[model samples]
Target: MAQRVFITAGAGGIGKVIAETYAAQGAQVYVCDQDHRALESLRDGITGSCVDVTDEAALDDWLQAGLAVLGGCDVLINNAGIAGQADPVEALDLAQWKKCLAVNLDAQMITCRAIAPVMKRQKSGAIINLSSTSGLFGAPFRAPYAAAKWAVIGFTKTIATELGPYGIRCNAICPGAVSGDRMDRVLAAEAQARGVTPQDVFEDYASGSSLRRFAEPEEIAQLCVYLSSDAAKFVSGQAIAVDGNTETYHSV
Candidate 1:
């Protein structure tokens, strides 16, 4: 049987690549994102709905619809996240902080809650939660994002233990400075917060990694595929980093 995979925020950015990668591997892929246009742009073999993860009812509807189409989910990738505010903690807005946690942390739990029973019945499944290198260390100007990502690692581990007895695996992927429009926007925000040029911030970020460069979205996407495959059947409760070994997150 073709593996049935579902992804969150899979309409664009890194999530789109992950979805496409699974589809290429002959998996039945279903994704949800808030961007209607981006969802429309998805290629053949991949299907998605425009959904805001923060809206529980809407998210549930998307998941139910996907479950109906795919029959059962063999893999779930919680890839929806935002960089949140690029400012000091004291300077952050309350609403923005809540929104960050809502998307990055809460939505993962929501999806897991809905899918756990289905996986339990089958006695086999894989769950990959997207974390960040920031979750492993301090991200100077991105407090909310860092906090939520850190929580993701803990959540991943906890669920791994809870689901292990039933043959379900859960893991967290911590990517660092992935090269793309998203990273460009993140660098731009950090630059504005630190009163420096985006190029300078970009250089600083690249230098922080031992590889001296950012990771490509394909790199992260490939890891997602691996973690859900039979090859990684024994890998669970691991917070693997796709980050070229980050050394620091210093500002320019």
Candidate 2:
């Protein structure tokens, strides 16, 4: 049987690639994104909808509807997140902090909560969370994002422990500077704050990793697939990094 895979924020960036990858692998994929136009553009193989995960009611409705169509969800990828602003913690906006947590961290809880019973009934499931390198170490100017991601690691472990006996495996993918438009924007912001060009900031990020390059979204997608497969059946409560081997979250 084709795996029923549900991914959050799959309209673009990493999520989009993940959705396409899973679909290509013959998984019955369902993706939800905030961008309606992007959702419309998804390949015919994918089932998609415009959904803002920060809205609990909307998220629940979408998940419930997709579960009905897919019959039951075998895997879930919590891929929705925002970088927030490039500012010191003291200078960060209160509203932005809340927004960052709303999507990056809290929304995953909502999705997991909804999917728990279904997976429990079936006695098997896999959950892959999109955490960040920031979760493992200090992210100077990106405190809000860092905090939420670190929280995700703890949350992932909790789910793994609680759901392990039921055959539900949970893990986190902590990606380093992913090469894309999103990274470009992040570099631009960091560049402005540090009085350097975006290219310089980009170089700094790449240098922080041993491979000295950005990780491709397709690579991350592959990791997601591996973790959800039978091969990784024993893998749970692990925070795996798909970075070019991220040496540090800090630029230095």
Candidate 3:
């Protein structure tokens, strides 16, 4: 039988790829994103909804609505996140920091709380969260992003512990420098912040990776799909790094 998969930030990037990969594998895929237009533009076979995951009530409603359409959710990819304020601590905007934490950390907790009952009732499920190398280490100018992502790892582990008896597995994926428009934007932002060329920042990021390159979204999607499948049934409370050995060399 096909599984029902619910993915946050499913409109594009790694989220979109994850949805498509699972759908191709015969799962019923439902995706949620704040960008309605982008969600609507996705190819066939995906059920997309507009959801701002940081808003607890709004996200709960959206998740419930998705469950209704999906029949039930066997897998959830907590992929919604933002590259929050990037600047020195003294100049960092509190609003941006709070907003980042709201989406990247708090929203994950709220969504898990809302879905735990359903997963427990069903007696099985898998939750895959998107973390970052920044979460595992320190980044020079990404205090907010790092802080929230670190929290996600801790959150995933805690839930895994509590949910294990219920047969609901929880794990996290730490990806490094994924290639996409979002990555381009990040490079541009870093360039602006450091007063260097975009290529310079890209080189610096790639230099630490063992592959000497950024990962494609499909690569990360493959890992997510595997974790959601029966092949990884015993995996839980693990933060798997999908980076090309970047964490070993890079502090962030």
- In terms of lDDT, which candidate is strongest? 1
| Candidate 3 structure quality by residue, lDDT tens digits, 136-236 | 88887789999999999999999999999999999999998889998898789879989999999888988888888888899999999888888999999
Residue 189 of model 1 has an lDDT of 85
Local distance difference test, each candidate: 0.92, 0.91, 0.88
Residue 201, model 1: lDDT of: 87
lDDT of 3 at 182: 87
Better of 2 and 3 by TM-score: 2
Q: What TM-score would every model get versus the actual structure? A: 0.94, 0.95, 0.93
Q: What is the per-residue lDDT of model 2 for residues 1-252, given as tens digits with 9 covering 90 to 100?
A: 999999999989999999999999889999999998998899978999888899999999999999999999999999999876668877999999999999999999999999999999999999999998888888888888899999999999999999999999999999887888888877888799899999898887788789998999999999999999999999999999877877656621
lDDT of 2 at 49: 84
lDDT of 3: 0.88
Which pairs of residues clash in candidate 2, taking residues 3 or more apart in a chain or in different chains? Answer: none
* Model 1 segments more than 4 A misplaced: 188-199, 250-252
Worst 10 residues of 2 by lDDT: 243-252
- Give the CA lDDT, 0 to 100, for residue 137 in model 1: 88
